[model samples]
Target: MASYFSRRTIDFLLYEVFDATALTRYPHFEAHDRETFAMSLDSVTHIADTLMYPYYREVDRHAPELRQGRVSVHPKVRDMLRALGEAGLIGANFSFEHGGQQLPELVNACLGYILTAANNSMLYTGLTSGAANLINAFGTPDLQSTYVAKLLAGQWQGTMALTEPQAGSSLSDITSTAEPQPDGTYRIMGQKVFISAGDHDAVDNVVHLLLARIAGAPKGTRGISLFVVPKYRLEPSGELTDNDVTSTGIYHKLGQRGTPAMHLVLGERGDCHGWLVGEPHRGLSYMFQMMNEARIAVGITGAGIASAAYYASLAYAKERPQSRRLNEKNQLDAPQTPIINHPDVRRMLLFQKAVVEGSLSLLLESARLADLAHVAEGEAKENYRLLLELLTPVAKTFPTEQGVRSVSEGLQVLGGYGYTEDFPLEQMYRDIRITPIYEGTTGIQAQDLLGRKVPMGGGKALQLLLAEMTQTAQQARTHEALVPYADKLEAEIERLRTVTGALLPYAQRGDTERFLMDATLYMELFGLVVVAWQWLKQGEVAQQVLSTRPPEGDELAFYESKVHTMKYFFHYEVPKTLALATRLTDPEVLTIASEKQVLM
Candidate 1:
């Protein structure tokens, strides 16, 4: 199958939109250059295509099997993960002091898209390893020395244990207890569910970053504490010891089946030991450190899924010969043309193209912000942080939502064959479903964006975002094709600010439910406006390229296609978001009293 990620798009986004090469000016990333990053990404892309993707269908057909309290992965998949670790691609974002290459996070994000597209299930083991490495970064020195190297090297795996039976998205409602023991370790007693890669055969042990309550620490969210609970005890010589933690059962899930959905029992025998990551009763704060990273990770997963489906459909469309074009069908036996010749098929492909590529642009931009947040100095760092926070929810939600839609459309492109396992679309649909639900659900992310993230840092982040959009609008004034689109974008931004300001008093009163409900609409509006900005940026890049005659015929068509797609985005997506902004302005509630039982 043809790769959906356009090298041209990558070039345009990195150099033209983001000036990615200039990141080398920062002392933190001076060790690398654009050529090195490109080479690394090329290597990852090869591994993804040759090894990871080859087993995607096989692993799906043969998921993890649990017996005797142990989850077993296919040996081939396990070996592949080990090979990825051996190649040192697992810790692409960590610092060199931690045995990583110290590549920029943007570069890693680009490389991650390849891995995810290849086989998302197998990628979890590596993803968790990176997450653990991050946790160790912000954690104590003891924690880093003990687990950081192993996680980065992929000798051990890690999982985030947040959800409990009673504590769905409401972490404040959690009741898990962590009692401090005399040996400086806490005895953790809790049941964590829906924990991905929680227990698997590939790694020798699993380290769970669990959230639980310390005794008499208050109630609700304030009392929570983050614990580093390893599946086994570590010896002084840096080897595994029996810790008595066990996987009671694993869930038979709908997608991403190659990885296990674990139900874990921590210290069931009153022996599970946990070391605190930070201060007591400060667990939620620390866990959020991981959550923010996971948010971007989730967005990348969604984009990767969409890219895979788009590539599959695009390949199918170019190769599958169907009925002749309407104008040429009069000759009783006119030769059949590729499905791309059909206007409706072209529409579907174009829609998929705009959505997947647009989502890719947004995701990579978020990653660029991540890198900027780290290496960028002074105002540049602060500005990038604002951009990162402002787009986090959109980055996470839009791709998942659009990915699901694109996979469905891809299935439609395949007709009857799409419904069966004979084609990859059905599995793609199944796999993409979990992205929105995992890391955080769309509703949860929406609430985070509007109710929390928007107001965070006194809305400096949001203002910074508005300033960038305004600057873009200023730049677009001279371009006839882009001016109207930029104007519409500015208008929507104003509308959002006005509606959000109007709701501030209610928001301040802790009437958070209504605020969050309206915030959902705000999130959708934000995604539409933000992606439109990306599309407009792409239009600017393509416009310049098209101004000069391209040396190659295909190169000119590719650039023109990008310009045409960006126009499609402005006309189709931006207008609809204006309605959502208007809806957010209304001070209506969706409480039980507002609707009849029949409607409910």
Candidate 2:
């Protein structure tokens, strides 16, 4: 059997299911058509499969070598990245004049899924470059022209620096400072820890978008400002010049060793030139522009990893022979069947399939919201923005947490072979473990959901999201087969409402940490219900289409499969929301109050 992403599934989602073709009706996407979109995706998939996927095992084996304060990735990996950059994939969504295809976020995300799925580390060089380009949009023209081309061309790479040893999650505690220089630029002096791709030698230069406090600025997050700090400065004519930024060392990782994580010292030589992006004291606002975008990317990364692990395990299970049923009625003896034939193995594979694919749907839906919000006009546009904001936390958290589960189950399916480096499952497991820890921990995302996101616009965001879910439920009610599922979801919505009412006041009363201690569980609860609703909506649409005009051949099978998967998620997975709701209000959870005494 061929191991490739299902192109038929992509077409169904792109053309039939989401009616993504309707995007052409919008002004922002007016210049693009389905053919161009399809071509771009196909090119990216080929590049990812051919160039990126092959390196996965080797990179892990020969992890970047750190020598004398400099880290060196495999030369071949660098060459492959250069080729990918030359293919215009590094800046897939940038405007045309910058040597990009000006693709919509939807198309760009679809393209990203392929590369990320093929090899996540290989995509980091481009991912950070694209992020820096977004910051460039708000930067000066000189800054834009100087940095954008190098980044987009993959001649240079980009990184976002915000973390410090003491200020891992507390931005207000960040002590890095930027002092205004007489020459209009600021001199940034700070040590950033755990900076991803902070100092990869693959590119000509590395541009860092750093967050630092200005001298004499107010205390806390409000005093912070964002800076475009390149590792090497640009000359008067737009060429490289030496800057004070240098990496001190690289952090040895548990997995994804192909991508270097470095600890960097900025302005060690007494002058590191940096251009301030946006307004001073407004860094968080601007950084969120990148952070929110990266959140969605993280979700995609999680989904991609899970997808890879799931398929790999599926192939392994179908071929690797194992012990037969306990009560077999074989007369002489039946040859041991493939593990996939066993009920337990099947259960594991199904769990991975559901979580991985469910996570994919959630991540892609968030990307679609990004597209709709950017292109649509009037009320639809605002509604999309509201929906996007409401789900961004879920987009980041659910997939990552579930991704870990999927990978673990994948490894378990391989049993003992999974524990050795000889197999890829262990590496996948290690690589994905960090997803929930970094890029805003799962706890942080949950707090954001309960504290900031849900209550934004006086709770209008949550209201809009609930309304959309309600509309889907009402629509699904028309189908007799879906009514029960819809009714269960409706009941979950009511539970979510009751829990939200209890938690909100506790958060407001300055027991925010206690409120958020349970926030992560609540986040999963909300996500399960919300994702079930999405699946239900998709199922309803598939049902209606199948009833009125049955799909032919594989198309019919695909639609039917979607319907069954949706049912699986609803009936088996969504009911867990009830347990979560109970856990949210459980008094026993507060036993953590004594955890400090235990530590003492």
Residues 1-600, candidate 2, lDDT per residue (tens digit)? Answer: 235255665666666656677877876677789998888887877777777788887877787766876678867667766776788877877767666777777677777667667777664654565455666667878778777877777688888789998889899999888999888899889889988888767877888889999999889999999899988898889678878888888888897788888898888888888889878989888888888888888887887888788888899999898777656636337878889988888878877877776776677778788888887789988989988998999989988998899899999999999888887789899888888976799988988898888878888888888887888889899988889888987888888888888788776788776777788888999889877877886788789888889989987987887788888887678878889888887766553566454644
Candidate 1 clash total?
0
lDDT of 2 at 287: 85
**Superposition error at 268 for model 2 (Å):** 1.6
Error at 469, model 1, angstroms: 1.6
What C-alpha lDDT values do all the predictions have? Answer: 0.80, 0.80
| Model 1, position 477: C-alpha lDDT score | 64
- How close is every model to the real structure, measured as TM-score? 0.94, 0.95
**C-alpha RMSD by candidate, in order:** 2.2, 2.2
Location of the lowest summed lDDT over 10 successive residues in candidate 1: 591-600
Which pairs clash inside model 2? none
- Model 1 alpha-carbon drift over 4 Å, by segment: 1-4, 237-239, 328-331, 501-505, 508-510, 549-551, 586-600
